[model samples]
Target: MLRTMPLTKNLTLEQINHLIDTGHAFISPFGLNRTAYIVINHKPFMVVVTDVSINAIQLSGSWYNWDELEKMGGVFESEFEALKAVAGGA
Candidate 1:
């Protein structure tokens, strides 16, 4: 959608790399579903499949602001789904 300077610190570079290196080990519960961190066009996003909401899977991502990382983030559904759109044919 729109990219802006992030005003939140939901995730860090180390954490992001960790997520990439380790698949859902931190957030994985019961091994039913896992969370992932993906970067698109210089932005980072967290993807997870949850039944708590009607939409099921949700995404929280954005252009992180190193100075003040507590804002400017948005929600995304799935990385695969998002990438599909980015690939120019969703």
Candidate 2:
């Protein structure tokens, strides 16, 4: 079970915090699943889970650019499962 979520300008910070606090995780094109927090400009950000929450935040370029992160987007289908397997082995 994988799901793709886009962080749009409509989603607010509070709504995103609530979703992670509740248990549903989001998958980015970069393939970071179960990502509770995201670091943008050295600042930590929470993830959004609801449709309404998805419409509350103003997105900035620093958050959207994953190219700076090493090996950020190579993973594709089953990435989450592979990550989980690695975590479990560790």
lDDT of each: 0.41, 0.39
Predict model 1's lDDT versus the native: 0.41
Where does model 2 exceed 4 Å of error?
A: 1-5, 27-90
TM-score computed on alpha carbons, candidate 2: 0.24
Q: Which pairs of residues clash in candidate 2, taking residues 3 or more apart in a chain or in different chains?
A: 9-57, 10-55, 10-56, 10-57, 11-55, 11-56, 11-57, 12-56, 12-57
Q: Write the per-residue lDDT of candidate 2 for residues 1-90, one digit (tens) a residue.
A: 867566677878887888778866454343333233333343334443212122131122223323432123211234354344334431
| Model 1, backbone clash pairs (residues 3+ apart or across chains), number | 8
Q: Which candidate number maximizes lDDT?
A: 1
> Per model, how many backbone clashes are there?
8, 9
TM-scores of the candidates in the order shown: 0.23, 0.24
- Model 1 RMSD in Å is 17.0
Which portions of model 1 show Cα errors greater than 4 Å?
1-32, 36-44, 55-81
